[model samples]
Target: MFFNRKNLEDHDLRHFYKKLLFPRLVEERMLTLLRQGKIGKWFSGIGQEAIAVGSTLALEDDEYILPMHRNLGVFTTRGIPLSRLAGQWVGKDSGFTKGRDRSFHFGSQEHKIIGMISHLGPQLAVADGIALAHKLKKENKVTLVYTGEGATSEGDFHEALNLASVWELPVIFLVENNGYGLSTPVSEQYRCANLVDRAVGYGMEGILIDGNNILEVYNAIDTIAQSIRQKPRPVLVECKTFRMRGHEEASGVKYVPPHLFDQWSALDPLLNFEKFLLKAQIFSDIEIQQIKTEQKAIVEQEISSAFIETEIQADIQRELNDVYASSVYTSKNNGPSKENSKRYIDTISDALNLAMERNDNLILMGQDIAEYGGAFKITDGFVAKFGKERIRNTPICESAIVGAALGLSINGYKSVVEMQFADFVSCGFNQIINNLAKTHYRWGEKADTVIRMPTGAGTGAGPFHSQSNEAWFTKTPGLKVVYPAFPDDAKGLLLAAIDDPNPVLYFEHKYLYRSLTGNCPEDYFHTEIGKARLVHEGDQCSIITYGLGVHWAIEFQEQHPEYSIDILDLRSLQPWDKQAVETTVEKTGRIVILHEDTLTCGFGAELSAYIAEHCFEYLDAPVMRCASLDTPIPMNKLLEDQFLAKARLGSTITKLLAY
Candidate 1:
């Protein structure tokens, strides 16, 4: 009675049945393949097929959908070839991720399908970002993102729901309550009577439906999608259903109660839908048999063809090449001759203003960035000039904001996200390393976003507010790291980071924000990413550093005037200036690396090892490293100075000179 035959035409009803049947047959065949050792794994969506198929069919082709591991019906209903899906499951080159990832872990931009990562809750935040894009462009499109009952306990889920509701984005947060999250039952998931009840807490509309009834699912989603398009706002839809199998084929369903299965077996979606069609006279019994036969034959043929396709090759060059979307910028000393004096923070603001003015697709997001002008007031007045839509003031949800920035990047928008401080990056660390850093390598999707980190110490902001964490991202494969010493390099490097079509971590030293002033070009210009600057040239010893360390080395040289030192400021960390570093090492024949982070496992360790390996023959003495003591930064000025590398720089250089 929830589904009326009059609501759909006769052909539409038959086509819907076929769409629902395809995934069921495919899942059945895939399970058999798993048993036969033909495929690696399978997440069977046997009973919950209606939710995936009906929800997918309800949306337009242009709208984006983020589905979970068990949502194969979404792919089939969207008309993805069965052969390609088979290839993906069997790890073939013909698959979306080219055998780099497994199952539905990869996304297809052509299909407008952003697949879920292993961390299920982060994708919800990604959906918020895609919906934010639609709202900004004033497009009549909605983004539907999925989550299971288990992922609801994650902080990202609450953060994403709160954000979408606050912004009133056109999003449908679909929670497929299949009774169990892995082995844990719904009773263990939450205390709420119904999952939809939590939607009211976030100030959004809530709806609950019987997921086993395909007609009801389709009708409800179709209505909700249309309504959201007319008036953009988020809605939470909870589908009540049951998982008929284990979390995956490898895990047996012994933990499930036998009576529950017996009770739900009669409510099977595919079988019930077939019975309804025959009883309603929409299809004869013979016609239903013929449709099943046709779908089975198609599934068989696609599976056979997919098995015969070429397997993934072990090409080391291709694997290495696909890690990053763009090569490092190698050109150096390219700034204009004419310049004007400006402070480091002012030049950063200037570069951002110019980049936003030139590219309408570029947007900025951070805590208090729009109205309060950010924690450092670097973006002061940005809201009035660019409007609240472009200069977004995000909630204090670091994980969701970072995920949303990635969503905007993949959807053809450039984003710049400012962390209130560098130490706070730990909150959103998973999104940066797992999602943004690995997206391109997994699926060849570039994430063109910049995360501005207010880094380093000397401001007495204590352990939480003042810390240098560049080494964390430098070790990540798909990211670029930039740290500039003066105003000129700060402006140019920020511009260059915006121009690159990859994720970049721009570390702006808080100590030098107002302290350092230098001449910068009036017009737009960009310094290379992987190039170093020679601040003071000498032959006594080479001081290799970045951020505040560069200023420390220069200050030492100015005070001594006797020992000539080659001060090399590495502007970037990941693809650092290797040639420049080697040149200085060979010229001076003594190496002294300096940094503000702890001595153990700091970036100084990486540089020292590289110099010891490559430039060992040219060295006159052992490579020396000057870094902060291996302890947390103290709040007191005297203790902080004692903990700093600058306190021991002169002594360290003196020992190296004696060596």
Candidate 2:
């Protein structure tokens, strides 16, 4: 009586009891699969079944549930078969992902699971996106994102919450507070007294529940989820629970303090719910044992069946699935087509403006890129031409900025999002890397999004504004990364990327805005999407470069006419032109890769590796690389110049001559 526990009937208790044991079996079966080397790997959902079941049950079947790796219980409760899930784990034909997804990572559009992003905080933003889609469709469904207490520390989480609250969208941000974010305890991870307090920070309702009590979890969520359906406002419910097992199969428990482990284990949600069921006389010990045995048997049978199943295998050709759903027609711009030689600056602006004109579905968003025309005025007068709907001004919330763009992309709009400064891209790293870069790989959905960021160091904008982080996205798959030094290439490449079906990260060099200008045609001529441009051809040695460094290499070749050097501008970094690179290296017998980013793990290093392995026979010299000093771009002019690869010719020529 003092605890105020609801007097639930045997039927209700049975409902809760059955739901609670589901994830336990899922966990135990997966753990067994891990031991047997059948499942790929995962973070166990052992003691958190009650939280998953209670929260998801409160919503309708059509409502979206964006879960993490640990929410297998949530997905299963929503009616996805253990066999189909097992197929996903074994990467078999019968798996949900057609064997593309690893264990604990499954998505079912029919069940409204929509997506399962393994990375932490990005899902929060994506969940908001699901709600946005529902709102646009005028559907009465809400989106619930299951994240951890630790993910609250991520910027995408804050970005998504703020936007949801601002727009009053139908979204439930549920934080599964299992005491620890992997090895880091919650106490060490967050500064707030409780994660629910974060809800108020974003102007939303904050609900806390006794996560161990399945009934309480259900009751708390049901009330809020009902309110959301009526008015469509967001709510943040923090479920105070614990993970009884280690973080994952690979994680060791030696690091967790002994006392913390003992305390959390005692409150294990699954066992507590089972005990509650037994005490209420809803089910006898025999029935409970029978249920457990049945669940285990079912899990085992599903695992065995997955080994023999075939329909679930993901189409490997699925990789070629979502490139340009609608036929996008390209037209040569009379304003800047190749026939008429116009000023380079005018051509660059014409290229972007024309691409947006050709496709009404294209939307441009960024800071100050609207009215002020951008810092370099690349987007000057775009707002006036396109109006706010097509060319919108976004809040300086970089994470939300990109997250919103991704949402728009997923919803059938081709978005051209700009970053005022590329250095600040780190603020939205979670969205770019975890969400944008892995959308196609992790989920079957394609992200036809484009991001344009100003890069390079010569402007003296200081440490915060001037930096090159292209190598960051270069390491990630499912992203088309490009760096253009010339205006013609920039215009053509930007058009091609906007037309491509995947996410593209276009890096614009700040120094190249007006440094070097070339006449560009008025007609719409696309430099092939993954094609590189040979700026200048020679025979003495080959200089491979991109971004602002390409111009520098061209100027260097002109000054030294005696040395016949070939300059290959790698416009597209992801699917770089290997044939062009090999031919140049073979003809010259010497190669030097150059870029504006730091020397350590730069794109230049990646090119050097390619040459070392593939073009070893054609090379008469060891591949050399000229890049920025391995340090942060300093503010001072001398330091910036020294760090900007300004002496590309002196360094690369010397190395080539020596070779």
Clash counts for all predictions: 0, 19
Give per-residue CA lDDT, model 1, range 175-223, as digits (tens). Answer: 9999998999989889999999999999999999999889888888999
lDDT top scorer? 1
> Which stretches of model 1 miss by more than 4 angstroms?
327-337
What would the per-residue lDDT of candidate 2 be over residues 129-221, giving only the tens digit for each residue? 567656655777778888899888877788788878876779988899988888898879988889998787888989888776666777787
The global C-alpha lDDT for each of the candidates, from Candidate 1 onward, is 0.91, 0.77
Model 2 RMSD in Å is 4.9
Model 1 weakest 10-residue run by lDDT: 327-336
Q: Total clashes, candidate 2?
A: 19
The model with the greatest TM-score is 1
